[model samples]
Target: MLPNTLAQEMPRALQHLLAREEQTDMTTLPRRSFLKLAGAGGLALGLYPSLASAQAPAAAGLKPFEQPTAFVQIAANGDVTVTINRLEFGQGVQTALPMILAEELDADWAKVRSKHGSNNPAYADPLFGMHLTGGSTAIKHSYTQYRELGARARAMLLTAAAARWNVDVKTLRTQAGWVLGSGGRKASYGELAEAAMSQPVPEKVTLKNPKDFRIIGKPTTRLDAKAKSSGRQNFGIDVQLPGQLTAVIARPPVFGAKIASLEDGAARAVPGVKTVLRVPLDRGAEGVAVVAEGYWQAKLGRDALKLQWDTSGVEKVDSEKQLAQYRELAGQAGPRHFDADMAPLANAPHTLEAEFVFPYLAHAPMEPLNCTVQIGDNGAELWVGSQMPGLDGMAAARVLGFKPEQIKVNVQTAGGGFGRRAIATSDYVVEACTIAKATRAAGFNVPVRTLWSREDDIKGGYYRPMHLHRARIGFNAQGQVLAWDHTLVGQSIISGTFFEGMMVKNGIDATAIEGMREPYPLPMRLTVHHPKQNVPVLWWRSVGSTHTAYVMETLIDEIARATKQDPVAYRMKLIGDKHPRHRAALQLAVEKSSYGKKALPQGRAWGVAVHESFSTVVAYVVEASVKEGKPVLHRVTAGVHCNLAVNPRTVEAQIQGAALMGLATCLPGAAITLKDGEVQQSNFGDYAVPRITDMPQITVHVVPSADAPTGMGEPGLPPLAPAFANAIARLTGKTPRELPFKLA
Candidate 1:
C-alpha cells in the first residue's frame, strides 16, 4: 500500500488533464475548420505571432502528439517534453528511446525533456503484453512504434503550416522544429503549435529511409551522460525521502535456515537506533531488521545484535559436493530431452566427448539493493528501482493485505540490474514495508527505507546456478560433423512456485535449455536437460546462453582439432552460406585477426568462436599467451552483426562494455562457497572485477543491415568466454573444461 498523499495525488493529476480537456470547445468540427479555429483562438488569446499560424486538424479528431506508447507535449515557451515508460537501468534507454521519437518529431533536441511514464497497459509492449523492460528488448520493441509516433506529429505540424500559408504540404519540409515552404517562408513549430495540436493523427504514416535519417543511426552522445558523470543521476541507493528511517537486516548463515531468537540489548542501546524488530522472513528465509536514523547507525545496530539460527536442513550443502552430485546425474540417461542422441557412433568416424563445469555467479550490482516504503491510512508508497514494477506492486500488496491498486510504485534508475532487480519477492522492499507497518502500529508515523550492504547482497541466493554439461560430437572422414549429443544438469529457472504455471511440457525450462538446442542444420543432434532441484538459481546477464555458448563453442573447437582442419574453415563449413551476416562476421573477425597466419612469440596462440544470441550474430578472435603459468589476453578482435542500429555509438559502447564484463567473469570471479552454504567472497577486495591494467586492446567491427534492430546488450557477452577458453586450450594443449580457467 502506498502513502495516502501519493495515492490521493494520482487521481487529482489525472483529473487535471481531464478538466483541461473539458474546458476547450471540442465539438465536432471538420479537420480544416478545427485548425483554423484553433489558430484564431490562439491569436485571440494573445499567443505569440509565431504560434498563430497553421491549418486544420486531421480526420478522426486525433491530436498531433498523441501516441499509444508515449506522448509528446510542446509548451508555448518552446519546451518539448517526451515521456518514456521503460525503465533505464544503465542501458542508455533514457537517451536512446527519445532519440527515435525526437528524430521523427523534428523537435529541437537541445530543448527536449524526458520523463518516465506511469505503469499502464497503454505503454505495454505488444510482444510481451506488459510494460516491462528486460531480455535486452527495450530498443528492439519500441523502434517502430516510436518512429511512427514521431512521424505522425511531424505530419500534423506540416499540415497545420500548409493550411496557414495556403500552400501544398508536398512543397514544405521541416527541420529543427520549423516548417519551411518552397519560397523560404518559414514558421517555427511554436508558431503553428495550437493548429498542429488540433490536427488529426495520420492513418498511414511513412517512415524515413535509412539514407534520409539524420539522427537515428548517428552517434549522438547519451542524454544522461552528463548527469551520470557529474554524480547527479539518482539510483536506488541514492533515494531519500522526507522522514525516511534507514534499516539493515541480519540474515541467516545458511540457505533456508530459520531464526531461533534475537538478543537485541546491544542493538537497542546503540546511538541513533530507533527500533529493533524481529520480522518474519518472506519465503521461509531467516532475517531480522534494525531500524535507525541513518544507514551507518542501522548497520551498527544490526551488527551489534546477537541472533541464533536453526540450520538443520542446509548445513551440509556445499558447492564441491553439489558439483559431484551433478556429475553423477549427468551420467544417467534421461527421458526428458530435446534434440539429443546419446547412442554410440554407427559409421566409421572420429568422436570427441568432454564434460564442462560452470560455477554459480552473483550479479553484485554496484549500488546494491535498497527501497523506501511509506504506508499510511490510504495505501502504500514505494520508491525503488525494480525491474518488474507490476510484480513488485503485487508482492507489496500481498504483504500489506491490500489491493494491488493500493500500492504505488515509483520506479527509479538502477545502478545495474542484470536480472538481479527482478527478484519475485524483493527482500529489501518487503522489509521496508514491514518496518513501516510496524512503525504505524506503534503510533510513530515514520516510514522505513531498507538498505542492503554489499555483503548482504553478495550473500543472497539469487545466483546463476552452477551447471554441468556433458557433450559428444562425431565427425566423418570427410571432415563433416555428423552427430552431437549434449546433456545439461542445472537448476530449472522456471520451476519455482512463482513460475508454477509457466512450465512447458514435461517441465522443461526453456531458459535452462537455451543454447543446447541450436537451430543449426545438423544430421543427428540431440540435447537433454536433467533438472537439479535443490540449489536455488535465477537468471543472470546472458542466462543459460552464458555457459551453453561456452560448452558448444569449445566442443566445436575440439571437433575441429580432431578433424585437423582450420577452426574458422570448419565453422564456416558447418554454418549456412546463405546467412550473409553470420558469414560476414566470421570472415571479418578471421581476416582482421590474421587467424591462420602465424603464432605470436612466447608460445602465444589465437582462437576463434562465433555464436548468435538475442537475434545478433557475433564472432570473436582472441589472442592469448601463457606467461609464467597464467593465461594473458593480448588482444580481442570482434565482429558484431546488429541489424540497423538505432544509435551506432550506443551499440559500440554496449559491445565494449559487454566484452570487458565477459573478460572479467571469464578470468576469475565466482561466488565462493563455504561448507555450510554461506558465501565466502563478500566484497570487492576479495571478489575481483576487470581493471584498466588487465584490459586487453579490443577492436569491434559492426556489420550494418537495414533489417530491424536486434538486441545489443547480451549478444556480445556469449562469445568472449568460449573464445578465450579455446585460446587457452591451443596454448596449453589441454581443454579448459571448467570456468575460472586456471593455467598449470
Candidate 2:
C-alpha cells in the first residue's frame, strides 16, 4: 500500500486540486454519457474523475466532486436530493452536508433531502481518494467540494434560463431553486433540470462569500431528526432482502486461537437452521458459522453447537501482566520523538513526577456489527454501514475471489460506529464475506446477513490500546516550566496496518504521542515505546488524544495549583499568541462559564482544560463536586474553535455527544480486561458505559470565523476528561492517576 498522510490533511490537498481547475475548460464535456443520459430525459448519477493527490491518482477527467449530476437530483416537484459521500453514524452529516450544497444552490431548505452514497470511486474522498468517515474529516474536507458542485449546477440553470428567455446569462439570477429572468419569467430548478444537466461542466465557479451565506452558519434541525426520533429511520441492521438468511458465529476464546473440533449435529437439527460450517475468522482464528432464516434461529444454532478452540499457541494477554510490562517498558528509553534540554530538571525550585494508566477500551457501538452479502455467479453486493466502503468492498472481493469492480457496497445509515466500523483490516466485513461464501458452498446460494450479538461485540477485540504515560516536570514558583520529560508506552494502532509506513517513523508511532507539548511551548523530552501485543488494537474516538490530552492538561492544572496560579490564566500565559485558536477557545469557555468571577455552590469547583485535535480546538470549563467518594460533574461549558460551524446545531450536538463519551471514561467499570486468554467482560453488565443519570448539563459555544470549518467530532472529546479531572482535583487535593476515577 502507498503511504498516506493522516485524514485531517485532506482539505488542504483539495486547495491544490482547485488551483488546477482555476483555468476553466468549458468546451470539454465531463463525460459523453452524462450528456447522452441527460438528453434521454432521466436523472443521471454518473461517475467523475477523482481529484488527483500524491496518494490518489486521478482518472484524467472532470473531478467527481465538482459535478452536481452525481450528488444532487431535483425532482419535478422541486425536492432536492443530496447524496453524502461519508457515512452518517451520529455526526449529522446527512443534514449538515446538504445544508452546505443547498446554501450555494440557493435551494429552499424545506425541499432539501439527503441520502448516503456507495463505494463508487466518485464517492471517495476528494483528497484522500479513499472511502473514509473517520478522523472527523467529513465536513471539513467536503465543505468546499459540495459548495462548488452546487454553484456550478446553479450556474448551469441560469445559463439554460438565459437561452430560453433569449437574454444574457449574466442578467439571470437564482433564488430558492428558481432561475429568475427579466419580465417576470422564472423557472424552477426541476423544470430546467434536463436542459441544464446537458450543459458543459464548468472547471471554474464562484463561491458564495461567508457574509452572504444563508444556510451555512444557520442553526437548523437535522434532516433525519424527525425520522430518527419517530423510529422511522432504516439503519443497516434493519435491512431486509428477499430470502435473506441470518448468520452468527461462535468465535475462539482467545485471539488467534483456532477451532480444534466442532460438533454441529445438534446445531443443524435446530429449527430454521439451514447450515453450519467452520470458517476462518480474523487474526488467523477459526469459528463456526451458523446460518438460518432469522437472527434468533441463527443464534440458537450457534448456542447449540459444541465447539472447541485451540488456545495452545495463542497469548492469554492478562491485563494486569500487560500493565506491568508496559510500566517496565516505560522506564527504558527506546525512541525519542521530542528532545529538549533536561539540565534544569534537577535544579528547579519545584518538581513533580506522575505516572498515569489507561486500560484497553472497547468501541461498543450501539449497533453490533452486521453485514448482508448476496453472491452471484459473476459478482456480489454488500449492504452494510461501513466507515470505509471502498476498503470494505475490496476486502469482500478478495474473499470472494472476484475483481474489486464486481463487488458493490451499498453504504447504509448506522446507529453509532465511534470507530469500530472503520477497521483498517476490514475484519468484520471480511468475516461476513467469508461466512457468506461458506454458506454458498453448503448448497445455499442466498443472501446472508451476518450479525454479532452485544456480547460478541463487547468481547470482540480491536480495543483502544492500553497505555501508560510517565511525566516529570521542573518548574518555578511562577509556574514557568524549566524542563519536562515524558514517556509513553502503548501498542501502535498503525504498526501492522498500511499506515505504518506513513505514521510510524524510526520505531515510534506518531499517533501514540500526538498531543505531547502542543499549544504550549514546553521544553520537553518525549520517548515512546510500541510493544507488540496479542490484543487487537485500533483508534478510539479521539485517537492518541484520548490519553495524551488527559496527561498534559491535568499536569498543567497541577502545576498551576502548586504555584498558586489560576488554571485558566496559567494556560493562557503558556500558550501566549502562538496558538490563537486555542486562546480564542479558552477565552470563550471562560467567558461563557464565568470561570473566575462566579463562585459555585459550596462544594462545586471550576476546572479548565483546552486541547486541539483533528485541526479543531475545544476548551472546556466544568463544575464538579465529590459526592460520596465519586466525582460528579454538574455542568460543562465548552468553547470550540473550528473556524466556521456550517451548522451550529450539528457542532453543538457533536460536542454534547463527545463530552458525554469522554465522561464515560471516568465512570466506574468502564474498561475492557483480559484473563486467561479470554475477555472478562461480555456486555454492558460488566463493561460500563455512561447512563442517563451520569449526564451533566452541557452548554456549547463556538468562536466564529469565516475560514473553512475544521473537524468538530474528535476535538470535543479530548478536553472533556481533563477539565472534569481538574475540577475533581480542586475539590480533593489528590489528582486521579487513572481513568474510571478510582476515588476512595
Candidate 3:
C-alpha cells in the first residue's frame, strides 16, 4: 500500500494526467512528457534494471538509507543507469557525483543516465550518519564510495565475461562499457549484465589512482544545463496537482509575535477564495494560511483579510534600538573567552583601536519559500526545494501527528538556496500540510500549495544578526605585532534553535565568534564574546565570517598603515612563513592583480583581504574609486586554493558569483526597519540586489593542489566585504566602520 498521503493523491493525480492525455495526441508527445506520464501512471518501472524486483515496498520494517549508496544497473540494451543518493540543488552534485562513478566504471559517458535515489538511511554520508547534503561535503564525502561501487560493478561484469570465455580475469580489460580479451573478442556490459548479476559480489575492490583519472578532473558541462536553459526544469513553483488549491499566508509583522484574531469576511468574498484558517507559527509551524483557487487570488484574499496581532514582546524592538544595545554590549567585558587576553598595554610604543559594525541581512533567494502538500488521515506528503530532506520529513510528521515513516518528501531543484532552504525555521512545509489536513477534514480533498511572496520571505524567520567588533592592537617599536585584544557582540546564531545542541556551548555560538580567534603568530591574543538577546539570528552563507572577516582584515590594513609598511608584505609577515597555502594564495592574488604596480587610475586605490573557510584559502584584491565619497568597485581579482579542482570552470563560476554577492552586502544592500515594526524594504525594488550594471570585472585564478576538494559555495563571500572596505579607507583617508556605507 502506498503511504496515506500519496495513496490519497495517486488516483486523483493519475486521473488528471489521463484526462489531459486524452485531450492531446499521444503519438506526438515529447520523450520527456512520455517519461513523466509513464512515471505518474504507476508502472513501477525501475530506472535500474537490476532493481526491477526491488520496487520501493509498502510500509515495511526496512531501515532508511542512512549511508550513501552507489548502484549501477545494465539493461538488455547498452544503457547504463547510475543512482545518485544526494539531492541536487544546483550545486552540480548531479554531474559531479556521476563523473566519479563513470570514471571508475570505464562506462560510455554518452549512454549513461542518472536517477535520484530513494530516501533511505543507507544513502546517508558516512561522516554524518544521516541522509543530508550541506557543509560542502557532497563531493568529498562521495569521492571514495562512488568509485568503489563502480569498480566493484566493473569487476563483477569482467569476471562473468571471462568465465564465459574460459580466460583469466586479469587478462580481460573493460572500456566503454565493454569487456575485452585477447584477439579483441569483446562483449558489451548489456550482453553480460544478467550473467554478471549471478557472479559473487567482490569482498575487496581496488580504486584507480589519480594519475590514471580519465574524466574526474575534466570540465564537462552540467548535465541539467539544457533543461534549465529551456525552462523545462521542475522547481517547486512548477509542481501542479489535480484539484490543488493555492495558499498565501498572513504572517505577523514582528518575529515571534502571534495573531490575536482575524476578520475573514472580505477574504472569503474574493473570487476563487476557498478558506481562511488560523495555523500556529510554533517551533515547526508557520503563520495561518489563506487557501484559494490560485496563488494570486489567495494573496488578494490574504491582503483583504483584517487581522490583529499581539506584539507585546517584539513591539519595542527595532533596528536602531538593536544597534544601540549591540554597541553597549561590545563595550562591556564578557565571561566567554575564545582566546587568552593580552597582558595590559603597558610600555607599548604604538597602539591602534577601531570599531566596525555589520547590519542584519536576509538571504532573500530568487525563489521565495513554498511547498505543495497533500494530507490524509494516516500520512502527509510534501514537494519542496529543501536542502535537508530528513529534517523536512521529520517536520512533516510532527505537523501531521504521525510517525516519521508516514511522511514522504519529494525534493525539488531550487531557484536559489544560499542556506535558506537548509533551514526549517520558516516552517512553510508544515503550514502547507496543516492547511491540507484542515481542508481534507472539511470533506474537500483539496491538494494545497502555499507560496510566500518575496516580501513575506524577507521579513520571515531569522536573519544574520547585526554585529559590532571593537579591537585594540599594541605594537612594539620594531612594528612587530605584540598584543591583540578583540571583543565581538552579536546575537548567538545557534542558541534557542534546533542547531543549538550541535554548534553552541556555554553561551557561545562558534559561528558568532568565527574569525575573532586566530592561529596566526601573534604574541598575545585575546578573543572575547559578548552575546546579545532579543534578536533572532541564523546562519547566513558564510555565517560569522561575513562580519568577522570584515573586522579582522580591515584591522590588519590599519596596522599596516600605522607601521608604514606595504599592506601585502605586512600581511605576509604577520601570517608567518610556515603556512604555505595562505602564503601561496596571497602571493598569487598580488601577482595576478599586479598589486602596487601603477596605482589604479588617479583617484582609485586598491585593497587586499584574505580568509580561510571550509578548508579553502581565498585572497581578494579590489580596485575602487570614491565618487563624492561613495566607493565604486571597478574590478576584483581573486585567487582560490581549492587544492585539486574537480571542475575548474564551476569553481571559477562560484567564486565570481560569491564575489558579486559579497560586494552587494558591502554597499547597496541592507534589510531596513521602521518605528512601527514594519520592514521598510520589501521586494527587489526596495531591497536592492546587485545587477549586471553593478557588477565589476572579476578575474578568478584557481591554485591547483592534489589535496581533497574544499567548498566552493561560501568561501568566496568572506573576503569581498573587507577588501572593499579597506579600499574605501585608502580612498577617503578615513576608516568607515559601519556597513552600507553612505557617501552623501
Candidate 4:
C-alpha cells in the first residue's frame, strides 16, 4: 500500500521524466504529444516529487535529486499556488513564503495564493526532517528552499518560451508572470504552461542578489489579510464537514487524576446527546467524552454528567508551597551549567542578592484546541491547527491501530499558538483521536470534532513552567562585575520527552538555561534544579529566555544605578563590543527613542533593556509611570535586529503583538496558579491577558542588513517586561522581585 502511494506522490516534473525513461523509441512519438506531455502539461495534483527521504539515491533506481512538486503549482488561469510547509498561526508565513517563491518565479504577486500543507513527508522541516513551526524557524529554514523552488519553476517556463519563439533561452527573461524575448515578443506563463513541462528540472540556479530583490525584504501585506479581515478565512475551529458530530470531554479537575466512577443517566437523556464513554487522556489520566449532534449539545451533555474522581496518588501542587520549596532548593546549588570561583563574593565592595518568581502561564491561543477526525474502513483523516503534523499523524495511527501513512493529518490555519500547538506529547491530537475511536466503537459512523472551551484550554495541564531565580552578585564601585552566582529552579520541560536525548545533558535542560551570561563578560556560576512535578510544562513563547532575560537585564540596571553611572552607558561598557549586533540594536533604540536628549513628562521615566533570543537581538526603550501604585507602560520604542526583514510589515506586526503579550506579564492577574492540585484560574476573568486598553504607543525600527534573517516572533517579548520593570523601579526606588509587580 505504501509503495503504491509513493508512486502516486511523484510530482509532475518527475512523472514526465519517468515516462520518458520508459520510452523505447522516442522518434515514433508524435510531435504535438512531445510538446504537450514533455514537461508538466496536465500535472496531477499529487505528481510532485516524493518525500526527500523516499527519493532514493541514483544507485537505488531513483532520481538523485528530489523534485519540487509538493510546493509549487501553476493553474491554467495563471494563478500561482505555493504550499507553505509551516502553520500560519498569525506569524505571516502564508504571505512571506509565497513572496519568496514568487520573487524567484517572477510570478505576479497579485495572482499568488498560499495553501497550508498536510502531513506529507515532502512538507517536513528542511533542518529537522519533521513537521514543525516552533522556534520561529519557518522562515529561517525554508527561505532558500522556497527560493530555489521558484527559480526552478521559472527556468522551466523560460525554456518553453525560448522553444516557442525559436530563440536561445539565454535571451529570455521573466517579469510579472511573462517571458520577454527580443523585439518585444512576450508570452504569459499561462500560455507557456503546457510546453514548459518538458524542460529539465535544474539542480542549480543563480539566486538574485539582495540589491536586485523586488519582492523580498519589501513591506508586503499578508496574503490572507482580506479573507481573515472579511471573516471568510477558515480556521481549524471553523471546520464543519457533513455528518460530523461534536464531542466535549470532561477531564479530571486534578492533573493526572482518573475517573473512579461515572453516572451518565442525565447526560444520555439530553436532547442531542448520542453516547457517553470513558477514554484515555494525556499523562496516564482518564476523561469522559460527551458526543452529540452539535458543540452546544455536547457541552450541555458534558455539564450534565456526574462523576467521581480518584486523585489519591496525584500530587496536589500549591503555588505558595511550591514557592517555598523553590526557595529551599535555591539555597543549595544544583548541577552546574557554568563554573566560576565564588571566593570574591565574600569581600566584594558592592553586593546585591535578589530572588525573582515567575508563575505558570497558559498559551491561551485565541482559538482553543480543536481537532476533527474522520474514520473510514481503510484509514482515518485528521484536521487540526497542528504545528507537528507528523507526530500528530503517528499518534493518531497508534490510537486507531493503523499504519502511520494510513492517517492523513491536515494542518490548518490557527489564530495564535505561541508554543502550545507544538508539543512533545501531541496531547490534543491524541485526545481527539481517542474520542473518535470510542465513537466508532459505539457504532457511530460520523466524523468527530473535539472542541475545547476557553475554560478547558486555560485549565489544561500543558503550560509554561513556573520558575524561580536566585541571584547573588558582587561588583566594583564602577559597576564592573566581580562575581555572579545564579540558581534556577523549575520543572524540566524536556526531561522525559523524546527530545531529552538531544536537548538535555548532565542533568540540566539546555532550554532551562538558554539566555544566561552571554553578550556580557560576567564571571558567573549558573546552577539549575529540575523538580519532577505532576503539572505538565512545555516551552512558552521564548522558552527560558522569558525569565532569564528579565533577571539579567534588571540586575544589570540596578548595579549601574548603585554605581551612579548611566544605565545605557554602563550596558555598553559591559558589552565591550564583542557582540556587534546587540550593540547596533541597542544603539538604534536609544537613538530612535531619544533616550537621553529629550526630557520625559513628569512622573514618567525611561527604561531600557536589550536581549538576544532565537538568534535575534531586540532592545526596548520604554516610557513608564506608576499611577496610583500600579505601573503603566505609556510608550515603547523597539529596535529589532533580525537581520534582513523578509516583510517589514510582518516583522512590525509580530513585534507589536509580542510586545503586547509581554506587557501582559506585568498586568495584575497574569500568572497561572495552582491550589490543591487544581488550576485555580479557569478563564480570562481570573487569568488576565492584555486587553486593548492596556496597549501602549509602540514604534518598531529594524536595522538595515543583508544578512540572513533570524527569528522575530519570540524575541520581541522577552525584553518588554524588563524594560517596563526598569522604568517602574526608577519611580519606586525598589526592584521588582516577581512578575506582576507587588507594590504596597
Candidate 5:
C-alpha cells in the first residue's frame, strides 16, 4: 500500500481503514455507512436482525440476530434450505457457503438446498457489514459466521429434541440431521422443525475442528450444477413478471456527452414499441430509452432511433494519444510510493530496462448487465445480480424518491460479473429504476427490465484503466537486486468513487502501486501518476494485479535468465522462508508441473509465475510455445495456498476460467482501443475473449492447510498472464511489452 497524507484529515470511519489497507488485506473492503459501525468492531453473529427491524421477536434467551428461522428452514420431507448472504456470480458461493453451514449443522448433503439472499441487513457481510460479494470476501470473511449459524441452529434442534425425550440438552447429539437422545430416542431435524425454531437460539456454539469436518475441504459439486447444465437456472436477464416492459437505451457516443437533438418518430413506428422517453443516464449524460413489449422489439426500437450532434464538449480519447501522454507522465518526477535509494543502479554489473503497456479492458461477462425494476405506489422492488445491494438500494431510492427501506432489492444469480456489476455508481440499477419510473409516470403501469446488449455493455460500460509501467532494475550476476526504479501511469479506478477516500491518498492511488517489491525484497523507488481520463473505469477481476503481476514476474524471470540460474531456485532463494504460502505454492506448482525435471514436448518451454492477491497466493507453471505466429499455452498447473479449500472443485474451476481470461490479454484482438472517443470494438468478433479452442488444459493443486481461508476468486487470475509471457519470452528472444501482442 502506498503512503497516505490524509489519514488524520479523513472521517473517523475512513481513518480506521488505514491499518487494514497498510496490510493490503482485500477482505476488509468497507462501505460508507458500514465503516462507522464496522470501525466500532465486534459485529455480532447473524448481523443482530433485531437491530435491522423491530419485527425480530424478543424470544426467551434468544439474542437479536440469532434467529435460526432467518437462515435455515427444514421441510417436512427432511430437506434443509440454507440462505447465502452474497450474490452467486458463478464464483460458486451458492454451493461453497452452504457447504460451510451444512458442515456444522450436520445436514444430509443430498437434501441440502441453497437460495439467494436480498438487500436484507441480516445478510450483510459479517465483517464489512455491507451487502457485498466482491473483493473475494464471500467465503474468507463468512466462513466462521456461517459455521456458527449452522451450529446455533443445530443447538436449538438438540434442545427441542431433548425436551421431547425428557433428557438434558447436553445429553443430546446430532448426526446427519437427526438428534439422538438417551434411551436411543431420535428425531429427524424436519420432524422437530417447528418446535426447534420455537426454542431459544444459542448465543455461541463450538464449531467442528478440521479433523471433524465431514463436508468442508471436499471437492463437492455445486448445488446449481444440474440446473445450470440443464439450462434451467434463471439469471437476472431471465427474470420476467406480468406486463413487464423491456427497455434499451441509446446512449451517447462518448462518456458524459449529452444529446443535442432527438428524433424518435422511426423508433415509435417500430412494431410493439410502447414509448420512447429521454432520461438521465450515468455520468450526467442523457439517453433515450426505447420501451417495448419484449427485448426484440426494444432492440429494434433502440436501433431505429436517430439523432445526434453534440461532441464538442467532451474529451475524445484516442488510444495512441493517451499512450503518448502516459509515456510522458512516466518519465516525469512524481509522488513517491517507495523512494528507495537508486544510486546503485548507475553502476550495476547487470541491469534490465523495460516498459509495459496494458490497454483498457472491458468486463465482457457472458450475461451482459441487466436489471428489473417494479415500481409500486410508494415502494419499488429490484431484481438484479448486484454485488453491493445496500448501495444500489440507496441509489434506487434516490432515483424513485423513496426511502432506503421502501426499495427492496432481491439479489439474483449472474452468469458472470468479473467486476462490472459491483460499480459504486450503481449505474445499471439506477438506470433501470429511472426507466421504470418513466414508464409508471406515463400511464404505463408496468415493471421495466432494462437490458444492455453485448454491444451496449462492451461499448458503453466502465473499463479497466489502461496502464503504463516503466521499470529499470539493477542486480548482480548472482541475481540479487541492487535497485529498482519503477513508475506507473494510469487513471485511478477509485478516484471519483467513495473508495477514493480509503484507497487513495497523497495524490497516489495505492491500487496503482500494489503487487510491487514484496515476497522477494528489492530496493525500489516506485511512483505513480493518476491522470484524469474521460473514460469511465472500475476494478476488473484481480484489479491492480492484472498488470502489476505480469510486469513483476516476467521481469524477475528475465533476471534469472541473465544470471544463468534456475528461475525456481532464484525465486526460492529470494523468498527465503518469510512467506511460507508463496514458497509452498511455488514449490507445489514446480513439482506438479515437473519444472526442470520433466522434458517438454519439442518447442514447448516452462514458464513460471507466482503472485498473492486478496490475501490468497496462486502460483502457476505453464507449458507454452509459439505456434503459427501466435503464443499458445498448452497446459497450466496451478499451486494455490488459499489457507483452506471449501470446495476444491470450485477452486479448480475458478482457476481454469481466470487463466483463460488472462490468456485473452495476449490475443491479437483483446485490446479495447478507442479512436476519436469512440470504441473501435463493439462485439465478441472484434473484442477477443478466449473461445473454446483457446482453452488450455489446466490442473489445480492446493497446498493443504488448516488455517482460515483467504480468497480464491481473484488470486488465480494475476499469475496466469505472466507465466504465459515468461514462456513466450523464452521462446522468442524479445520480450513482449504491450498487450494484444503485435509481432513484427
Candidate 6:
C-alpha cells in the first residue's frame, strides 16, 4: 500500500495519473513489435537482448562494453520510443529526458513513449562515466548527450530522405517525424529508419539553437503521470515472475551483531513456507532468510523465528548520549573549513550565540527496498529499481563468481528514492544477491525476491546522519555582520565508502558542507567534526543543504530582526549584485507573493527565505500564524530559477513535493532515533510524515530564462522550513532551535 504521504495528490491530479496508469496495463511497451523486426533488414535502434550473451567469454569480455545505439527507436508504424538512461523515481526524468530527445529528433510528440534503460554501458551517465543517478545530476549531465543522440538520429533520417529524393542534404528539413526534401519530397522517420541505419553515422551534427527550441522549455505534462496514478506502472516492488518465491530476513537488533543461536521450528511450520537459509547480510550482520510462496507468508515465517544475537563489541548508540557528545564537540572547534578572523567578536556591540540540533532522517521511499534475482548456469539476471545498475550488476557478478558480462540487470521504475536507492556499497542489492546465492546453494533454483516490510525498512539503516550546529555572530545595529564563527558536528556519509577518497578531503566530506556561507559573502570561520558512529548514514535529498540552509537562512533572518530591518531587504543587501540568479529568484518571490504590500488575515504574518542547492535557486514567501499553541502554515509562494524549465509542470511538481517533505521535517515525530542501538521508530504511526491536511496552499512560479537548466529536485526543499519558522518567529518572538517546534 502506498503511504499517505505519497497518496496526498490533489483529486484531479490523482484522477489524471490513475486514469493513465489504469488504461496502460504495463510499464514497458510491447517489445514484440520491435523484436519481430529482428529478422527483417530494417534498423532496430537501442535494442538489448533479453538475456546475457551466450557467447560471453570465460574471462572479462569486451562484450561488457557493448550497448545498443539504443536510446531512440522509430518503429515502422511511426511510433517513437525514447530510452531514459536514469531511474525515474517520481522526479520526472522519464518525461523530461524523452522531451529532450524528441525535441532534437523533431518527432511527433504524440507518437513518443519512454522506456527505462538498464545497466547497459550505453546508459551510463555521460559526464560521470557510471551508471548512477544522484546529486540531481541526471538532467544537468545528460541534457546535451540526449540532444546530440536525437540530432544524430535526425541527421541520419534526413540523409536517407535526401538520398531517396536525390536532393542535397542541406535542402531537407525535418518536422513532426517527417523529413521533407526539396520539391515536396516527404517520408516518415519510420519509413527511412532502415536506410538511415545503413548510412555513415554522422561524426558531427549541429544542435538546435535556443530560439528554435519548441519543446525544451515548455510546460509539458509528465509522460508516466497517468500510469503512476492508475497503478498500472510496475515499480520494482510490483514485479512478479512465474515460480518466484518471496524472501524476508530476520535481522539483528544491533548493527554488526552476529547470530548466536536460532530456532526455525515455528518458522518452518508456517503454511506456504518453503525453505530457510542463513545469509550473509550487509555490515557484517548475520540474518536468516525465510523463503515462502508469497510476501505475507515470508513475513510470517520471519516473525515466527526465534534467534539469539551476540552484540558484543558493537557500539550501542543512545540518541541522548550522542547529542550531548555533539554539543560538547561543537563548543570546541576541531578542523577548520574556512579561515576567518573572529577577533572582532570580543568587541562587537551586539552578539548572538545559538545551537541547533537535527536528528537522523529516513528516506523512507514509498516502495520499500526490493530486489529479485534469478541465477542460471549461463548467467544471472536481476530486476531492481537500481539508481546505479552498473555498480549493482558488477557487485552481483563478484558475489556470484560470474564474469561481469554474464550478469544482466533490468532496471525498473521506482516510486521515490530521495537518496536511498543510490549507494556506494549497493547494500540492498548485495543482500538480495546473497540471499539468492544461498537459496541456490540450498538446492532451490527458483527466482528469489527479497522484500523489506515497512518495519524492516524503517528500522533499516542508511539515514541522514544526525547533525549539530553552533554559531556565534557579532553584528552592529545596522545588521552588518562583523564576525561569524560556526561549528558543525556529524558523521561523514562518505567515510567508509568507495567515494571517500574523492569526496572527503582534509577531514571533511564535500557533501557534509555544501551549502555553507556562500551567496552571502560574510567574513566567517567555519569548522567541522565528523564522529564515527554505529548507525549507517547516507545523503537525504538536498544533502548537507538539508541542515545547512536551515541554519544559514534562519540565522540570517534572526540578524534582520535584531537590526529592525525587513528580512527580505536584509537578504537582498547580503546577496548584493553579484548573484543575479539568487537576487532575481528572491525578488520574484517577493513580488509574486506581495510580501510587503499584501494584507494578511488577522494574526497571520509573512515569512521569507531563499536558498540554492545543486545550482538551482529557490525563494519562498510564506504565511503563517499560531493557532491554539501550534504553528499553522497557511500558504506558500515559491520563485524558482532553474534557468530554463525543461518541463514547467515537472518543476512545479518537484517543488511542491519537496516542500511537503521539508515540512515533514518540522512535524512532530519527524525523526529517526536509536535506543539501545535499535531504531525506535518503525512506521508512519510513530515516524511522522505529513498527511494531505498538513500541506499548505502553494503557488509555484519560475523565472523565465533561456539559459541551460539546473537541478530542481532538491533546491525547492532547503528554504521551506526556515520560511515557516521565520513566520512562526514573528508571532512568538522566539527562535526555533530544534525541529518539530516546541512552543512555550
Model number with the top TM-score: 5
lDDT of 5 by residue, 69-140 (tens): 678888987899998888999999999999999999999989999998777766777555567787777898
lDDT of 6 by residue, 405-455 (tens): 778888999888888988867888899999898888888898999999888
- The sequence of per-residue lDDT tens digits that candidate 3 reaches over residues 690-730 is 88877999999888676767667778988898898888888
Backbone-clash count (model 3): 16
Give one clash count per candidate, in the order shown: 18, 0, 16, 11, 0, 6
Q: Which stretches of candidate 1 lie over 4 Å from their true place?
A: 1-69, 159-172, 182-185, 190-199, 313-316, 339-348, 497-503, 517-519, 523-534, 597-599
- Model 2 per-residue lDDT tens digits across residues 1-744: 111323323222111111112222221223443344333321123322232222222224666655677788889888999999999999999998999999999999999999988887668776555567888889877888889878877887887788888899998899998989888899998898777877776767899889999999999999999999999999999989999999999999899999888899999999999999888899999999999999999999999988887899977899899999998999997899889999999899999999999989999999899999999999899999999887788788789999777788899999898889988679989999999998899898889999999999998999999999999999999999999999999999877775554467789877777778887889999989988889999888988899999999999999999999988889989999888989999999999998878878999999899998888899999999998998999999999999999999999999999999999999899999899878899999999989899999999999989998888778899899999999999989988999989978
Q: How large is the C-alpha RMSD of every model relative to the true structure?
A: 10.6, 6.1, 11.3, 9.4, 4.1, 9.8
TM-score of each: 0.87, 0.93, 0.87, 0.92, 0.94, 0.91
**Residue range with the least summed lDDT across 10 consecutive positions in model 1:** 11-20
With candidate 5 superimposed using the best TM-score fit, by how many Å does residue 605's alpha carbon deviate from the native?
Answer: 0.8
The TM-score, computed over Cα atoms with residue i paired to residue i, of candidate 3 is 0.87
lDDT of model 2, residue 228? 92
Cα lDDT of candidate 1 equals: 0.71
Q: Please report the candidate that would top lDDT against the real structure.
A: 2
Computed on alpha carbons, the lDDT of every model, listed in order, comes to 0.71, 0.85, 0.71, 0.84, 0.84, 0.83
lDDT of 2 at 420: 90
Clashing pairs in 5: none
